[model samples]
Target: MNGAESLVETLVDNGVDICFANPGTSEMHFLAALENPRMRSVLCLFEGVATGAADGWYRMKDKPASTLLHLGPGLANGLANIHNAKRASSGMVNIIGEHSTSHLKYDPPLTSDIEGLARPLSHWVRRADSSDTIAWDTVQAVEQASQHPGKIATLILPGDTSWREVSAQVELPKRVAAQPKVPKAPDAARIAHIARVLQSGEPTLIILANKATRGLALERAGKIAAATGARLGSQFFTARIERGAGRVPIERIPYAVGQATEFLKGFKHIITVETREPVAFFSYPDKPSLLKAEGTLVHTLVEADEDSALAFEILLDELGAAHAKPVLQQRVEVVVPQGALNPLSIAHALSAAIPENCIVVDESLTTGRESMGHTMGAKPHDLINNLGGSIGYATPVATGAALACPDRRVFCMVGDGSAMYTIQSLWTQARENLNVTTIIFANNSYAILKAEYANMGAGVPGARALSMIDIDRPSIDWQAMAKSMGVPSVSVDTAEAFHKAMADSVRTPGPVLIQVRL
Candidate 1:
């Protein structure tokens, strides 16, 4: 068997059966090996599509899917979404192609360091030294990716190694289970310290993220808050948060450092579970990086890899506060709003119209943050975000999420600017007939960037700078574009119109786009 064949067999043996791919010359052999009926290969028009789809698949399936990229440039094209996947804690195996070892000595143009590019975002990176080692390397990659909380694993395969013949006698490595992260028990001294701080009559806040954002961890934290009057909050961005109707709701820390500092200033104690104290996403010229108030004490209740639920349970036991009922939000029936077109009205309409058993792919940036919180009480649904802070991921991720969970409807929310980044995702959605409702907030500009410019302390710009922020010189016709890509679509300008269109699309089934002109 050749190296490519052995690699495929090894991956299938390890339970990685799906591959999202946009291949080039170096990957031709691996592509051919995909003919094996055990492995399914999905062709994507762009590398970003491939990576985003893998991300969506992991979100639903909780299993790693593989992506086959060309050379360094192709991998670079997919890096943004891969970064997103990593942030989401979505596991994925990236099989990147490289020049043959023999050709590498001459330092060809495509010979950029794949390992260097991948290290920042990936938890595990490897390059197969020869055809004989491909099987073992592939197995390790799968193992790393399948770790708890998920991880990104990149395995580089050179062309010569892929096509080279390997001995059939070479045995595939045994697959090992990923190690589980065990939560450290709080010591008696630490527990007493926290207890004293809580009883000191000073304001305190408990911040949650990762496992603490959902299920028992959140419930326990709520109980602790109720018992001690501590404020409960989360980081501005999270991997996955189990929120919405009937679930415990925790407030998110404001994004701006000034606002976060102001919000947290009164607290004398800041306890963190599975996360750290609030910090600015970016460093500003005159702002402090940490958002905690001056003289506030920071305490670590649980580490990121630890089991937050268990830690909270222990804390509650030590405090003699178990059996305290956590506050839960009552689920509300959907009520469609009637008003002019605006961000608030759009959120209300969405809360009323999002169907039951649906998945929300949110990339609406500034517009959808409040909207998402409003919809939490409306229905039980899954919410996916661009965890990597990258734009242009929602559309393709929605497509993959739909494919992963065919029974659930997918409602993708994206801005006009971000949608154009990977609009090709619509074609794939249409071809698959996946039930997806795409809402494009057509403000016709890079709205998020505008906010960033101000946050970064940039002065109000002249016409030329403003022009770079604007995209309306030739406004895109989303309805026409959706139709051209074989997906039915409509344009709406009022809340009433958007509500009607969204309701109709959900009821009828199949893929449809609703362009909200703002």
Candidate 2:
């Protein structure tokens, strides 16, 4: 068998069955091998779509998916989203095709350094030197990606290596088990110190992230808060947060430095679980990067990658707070809202319409910050964030999430500008008949960048600069776009209309798009 065939067999053996691919000349051999029924190849219009879809698949399935990119430029085009996938701890094996060794010596234009571009975002990187080693190399890449918390593994395949015949039979390597996490116990003295602070009646806050955002860690944090009267909060943006109806909700620190500082001002002590003291997402000219209130004492109960849930459990036990009941759990029954639509009204409508056991993929950057708090009491659901802060992630991620959990509804909330980044994802959703309700916040501008410009100390711009921030010279008609992509759609300007549209979309089976006119 050729190297491409062996590589495919190895990935399938390691349980990576889905491949999101955007191929070119260099990848033809590997693409041909994809005829094997065991592997499912998804054609993506853009390299970014391929990478973003793989990311979404990992978020829902907790398993790595592969992406087949043509060459250096293809990998480069996909790098932004791959950076995001890496930050999210979403495992993925990127199979990057390269020119033959003989061709490389001539230094062709496409022969740019692929490894240099991939290293920053990848945890594991290797180039197959020969056809005989491809199988073993692929096995290692899969194992690395499948590691606990997930990782990015890039395997560069030279053209000659993929097409050449191996004299000896290739063998796949045995997969290694993920290493167990060992959480550090909070020191007794530190626990006693925090207890004294809580008893002292000084205002305090307990921040959470990672594993602390869900299940036992959240429950334990609630118990501690109930017993100690300390405020519960989380970082402004988390990797993966488990929240919504029936879950104990923690307040998120605001993204703006001034707002976060004001919010944190009352706390004299700030305790953390699986994260550090809160900080601004970006630095303003005169504003402090750290968002802690002046004089607030910061303490760490657990570090990220440590077993935060276990650490919280131990801390609760240490505080003699075990068995303390959580803050009362309540579920909000869906109630369709009325009135004209805006950000607030749209949030209200969403709170009333979100379905139970749903997965909400949020890339509606500027318009969706309030969504977390507003939808906190809605039906139980999983919330996935754009951990890599890249635009055009939500739609594709929603596609993969729907595929992974066919029983659950996937709600993709994206800003109009961000939606355009990977709008082609709509076609994939329609083709698969994925249960995705894509809500596009049609503000027609890069609204988040506008906010960032002021935050970055740039003086309010003249008409020319402002024009660059705006996208409305010719606004896109999302309904037409969705229809063209084979997904049904509706445009709404009022809360009632949006709610009805969301309800109708969810009640029916296939993909639907709701354009919320701003």
lDDT of each: 0.84, 0.83
lDDT of 2 by residue, 1-518 (tens): 88898788778877888999999998888998898798988888889988998988988787889999988899998998898888777889999999999999999889988999899889999999988888888878887887656789999999999998765655545433223324455465656666666667778898887667777878888888888888889877676677776677788888788888999998889988767788776667999988887788997766555666766676677678898887844776646667877667778888888888888888877888777778888888888887668778888788878877888888999999989989999998888888999999999899998888888878786799889989998999999999999999999988899998988888999899999998
TM-score for predicted model 2 compared with the true structure: 0.92
**What does candidate 1's lDDT look like per residue over 1-518, in tens digits?**
78998888888878788898999988999999999899988878789989998999888877789999988898999999998988787889999999988999999888898999899989999999888989989978988888756789999999998999987777766544333334455455665677777767689988887657766778888888887888888777776566677777777777777788888898899988766778788898999999988899998777655677777777788778898887776787766777787778889999888877778888887678678668878776767767578889998888888888888889999999999988988887887788999999999999888888888889776689889999999999999999998999999988889999988988876899999998
TM-score of every candidate? 0.91, 0.92
User: Considering every candidate listed, which one attains the maximal TM-score?
Assistant: 2
Off by over 4 Å in 1: 105-109, 177-201
